[model samples]
Target: MADNQLGEFLRARRGAVSPDTVGVPAHGARRVAGLRREEVAVLAGVNADYYARLEQGRERRPSAQVLDALGHALRLDPDARAHLHRLAGTAPVLPLGRTPDRVSPALRRLLDGFPGSPAYVVNRTLDVLAANTLAEVLHSPFSDLDNLARMTFLDPAGRRFHTRWDRTAQAVVGHLRESSGLDPDSPRLRALVRTLCADSPDFAGLWHTHTVRGKTHDAKHFLHPDVGPLTLTYLALDVRDAPGQQLIVYQAEPSGPDAEALALLAALA
Candidate 1:
């Protein structure tokens, strides 16, 4: 875990916000990257010294209201704001490095229930913990089904498999950011992030952005080698029995060309 993750988060977010975005007039060339320290203090309705202390790790505990104000000042989305609270030690910290390999029998049965749709279970690191037969068939382009981050950024076939590779990369990085905040002490998560940052420049750029997002309902585009182009909608639902796990189910429009493509993968499965 980082010694001062809260401070790092504040600095990254502070540098990401532009003066013009917050109505801070830019009369001359500024040396600072994003919003000046005093500018953030003023916008957040806090003292400059206090805000600086927060960023410097001199002040560790900030009230929920204060965090909320700072979140607003940083223009954080709902996920990022939640991450801010988590980093401040104000929110519930999720357990990490638990028995990630254990998938409930019921959940495994549920994945099989979706014959037409591709369904899978993933942990915080986006490891494919469990996948249905069709899901495995759909992701056949990847050399391994071990990690989504590796496949999306490192695998050569990732570019062709995911039609919207850029969007997929951003979402993957954002989701990992959220996971980092929740489980700062997870060495596995940290190592995975470091490997990606060192090996993939695209992952490095997105990781530095400090974007926080959790998987949710979204449309995904894919180009299966055997089935051609497909557009599918997916829902990512939290697994109540497993703390850091999500069950993702992907489906195409009924009787549409996408559905036919997905059916072809199902047949292959």
Candidate 2:
């Protein structure tokens, strides 16, 4: 078991919260960013010593009740809570090794039908396994298109492409966390993490936090060099047959400027 990883996650979550944020009154100047260990212990209904041991790797396995309490205390969302469960081996299934990365032909045909909407498939590690023509056109000259995570952090155009780069980058890392927790032994996932940790400080810092964020329907902004600017909503649907693959589709709201931009881009493509 990776005791240190769990310890690091606990510390990061602790450091992310502040006393005032959780309704605790501040007495004086503080050193750490978030609630102190004692405060977390109190809020979590556990003693400081026990919590400390859990954070220090002495306590490898925590009960479901304790983890649930900690989740509530830390204000974790559904995805984050699920990820915490996986990290603690309380999840439904723990995958043993690396999974396949192939995309089926039927899914590819479905993607091809979407001429206006941008659609693509991504693996657990956020690699773009398959994409429709519209998606390719909308992306517009990526420095590296092999992996979504790598493109978001390492590519020079990541900032311009994402528009809201900070949030988008963090979400990418969070997805990586969600994936890693479920399949801790994935060689591809481990190799990708090692490379990003070595090359990008932003990616390295976010990965340590154990913040998991599974993609859902959300507004996205992009500044394409060719199309200028576009705003769209995206949905991430799990490919039921593929264990680690997701079908993501992006489309602008009808009767909006963004939709017009999509039309123009489609014509150009």
Candidate 3:
């Protein structure tokens, strides 16, 4: 919406953070909504004037070192840090507007090889590019629904499936926000966001928070109608030479009910 995406991003993130969160005293009434430019400069160990210039879009680009400093000062998580880097133009440039939904032959082979695990490839926006038989069984509901973002926000099934529905929803929205930063003008993402915003008040609120996060490893709890509840860990593998493609593998803990459920799901698949 804003002409300078970076400026908007910075303002959003700044507004999201509280002074107490960063160990800064809320000394007096402030004019600005969030941290003052001077406060951010102090935390980032940079000159106040320079930080102001960057926020104003006068300083278009930032060095990696400066970006890192800003990331640390902002207490940005990995996904947020990546968004900051992309906004600063410090992250590696990918092929212009390339959507990696078409599964490469090699990647398809890799998916086929993983018979034991439920695996799928997702684009930057978490669109399911491809999945193996097991993955298809595991995420059948999502496949039928289409668009992970939409499923997470708009579908009641998602609310039932995820054990930590609120937290999981936040992460999904955060990842989408990060992707939006990397490619602000992406029509598909914009459309998805607009649709979700229009349909779901919960999603709209989280989207306005402007949270960003990378696909870090995390535990997930799923309530499968057939297999019951499953507790699993996820591993996110970034595709080599593919800037935005990610291979997400889900595994159940050894000898647990989750593992048994997975076996059952795989067998049913």
Better of 1 and 2 by lDDT: 1
C-alpha lDDT score of every prediction, in listed order:
0.91, 0.85, 0.82
lDDT of 3 by residue, 131-197 (tens): 8999878766653635678778877788888878998999899888878877777778888888888
lDDT against true structure, model 1: 0.91
* Model 1 TM-score on a 0 to 1 scale: 0.95
TM-scores, all candidates, are 0.95, 0.94, 0.86
Better of 1 and 3 by TM-score: 1
Clash count (model 1, backbone only) = 0
In candidate 2, what are the lDDT values of residues 54-162, reduced to their tens digit?
A: 8898887898898899988988889988877777778764534344588999999999988889999998888899999889888866865689888888888898798
Q: Give per-model CA RMSD.
A: 1.5, 1.7, 2.6
Q: With candidate 2 superimposed using the best TM-score fit, by how many Å does residue 10's alpha carbon deviate from the native? A: 1.4
- Backbone clashes in candidate 3 total 2
- Which consecutive 10 residues in model 3 have the weakest lDDT in total? 138-147
